[model samples]
Target chain A: MADAVIAAIPPGRHARLIVPRLLQRGEDFTARLLIQHPMETGFRRDDTGKVLPANVIENVVLLFNDELVFRGRVLNALSANPSLSVQLTAQKSGTLSAHWRDQMGNVGSISTEVRVAGA
Target chain B: MPKHAQRRTLLGAVAAAPWWWAAFVGTASAQSSTAGSDALDERVRAAVLVRGGLSLDIPVIVETGTSVPIVLFADPSQLRPGVRVTRLGIIAPKNPRPVALDMELGALMSQARIATNIRLGASQSVTGVALLSDGTVWQQSIAVVLTGSACYDGT
Candidate 1:
């Protein structure tokens, strides 16, 4: 329920999953994930000279057809609008979904379908 | 010899052996246990302190305020069977917070290669660490010299 609530909150930035709409069975594919966030390191101060609290995506999880596939833990070192490229082998066509949670408990997710071509 | 006599002879031989031999075995086991703990300590330090690993795929030379690209790779076939590479992390030791990026590798993923962009606050080495499900950690670090610095005030 907490995750659902977090997911339901309006996303503060644009997040996109870039994948081919279709793929050939057994084809090796690369998927790119893009999420727009400041990746605040808490080291910077505001215009008023107050240190900003650190806020960053603590972890990210990716699932293919409800099976855990990829997971990542990120730190403040990532530049603004962090993106990741990952390789996958397409054994079967299915939905690839990604979920990420920030230090502040904000959650964001995106999904795309990959149609596997018949031999 | 009778079976009972043979058992008594074996016991007598063990009791007659020098105490130093027993000490040697004890010492060997103790040394092994220490080595295991030392390895675990190293892993904890690497994961937490961003200390060491394999090799980083970034230019040795760089400039400030630019998006630096980095890649980490490992042969999937070399990984232990049924063990998935679950986590990848990047850190710049000199930064305010050294950690840059960390991601999870999806299931049935073979290649352990990852690429991403990062910003440098100063000239420093960026460390990348890969974590496998089998508790194995692989790391690599590359040093990059930045000509300037990126100024930022949290807006």
Candidate 2:
């Protein structure tokens, strides 16, 4: 049964963080994040018509320089492997972290180091 | 100004802030009623009553698919002083489940602008609501005409 659940999710980069490697100080840049998950709503039935338990990512948090920049509580309506895009302004170089927590308590995180163009 | 009068004036201003805000943006609050209306309207009214001052950025017409991007945001730049948005919700009434998304904003993340994709079950209104830290609410909505319905999982 555990293997079946694991099989539902593909193996690859379960999480991806997209941020500009270099940016001008005080400039706003777009940061996008993609996480690979089945986002199973638990309402779908298996091949035998048995209902699968709901398992969806419920929490997402983004941090820059250890500061909470974004937090989201996602619902099942989001498509599988959800992607989030938001605007963020940084005045200094720092690390951006993307963290995801699913309903099953599974956690994943990714971080990227960013630098200011001339700073 | 006498000290007692100054204190009274300050208290008066503090007491009137929330009411003033609710009255200033009257549209959402005025239309907010979760009575014996239909399922969709009830959800919209409930969301609106929860909070207001939210806006949905999406096209009026959309091609239904597994992924239809929608943007919901609250601009704190023009907000009244001391107004802080603490939570946001995205409601798609026509879907099998109405609440598409709900977000909690931290102190440093009070200003929210989220870009996410939603699956529309049918042509319907998508609603967004923002709950202020001071117990005030604001809401915004957008109607999308879907050409087709997305596949549901029997939810």
lDDT top scorer: 2
Q: lDDT tens digits, residues B12-84, model 1?
A: 7555432222222232234346556555444443332222233568878876544677787765666767876
Q: Native-vs-model 2 lDDT?
A: 0.70
For residues B30-145, write the lDDT of model 2, one tens digit per residue. Answer: 33454333543433333324334567888788876467888878877746788777766777777776767766666644247778887777888777777776655667778889
Runs in model 1 deviating more than 4 A are A1-12, B1-55, B77-84, B133-136, B150-155
Q: Candidate 2's error at A64, in angstroms?
A: 1.6
- Report the TM-score of the second chain of model 1 against its true counterpart: 0.60
DockQ of 1: 0.37
For every model shown, the clashing-pair count is 18, 8
Candidate 2 lDDT by residue in tens digits, A8-103: 764323788898878998887878888888777665677778877777787788888888776775465887788877777767788889887788
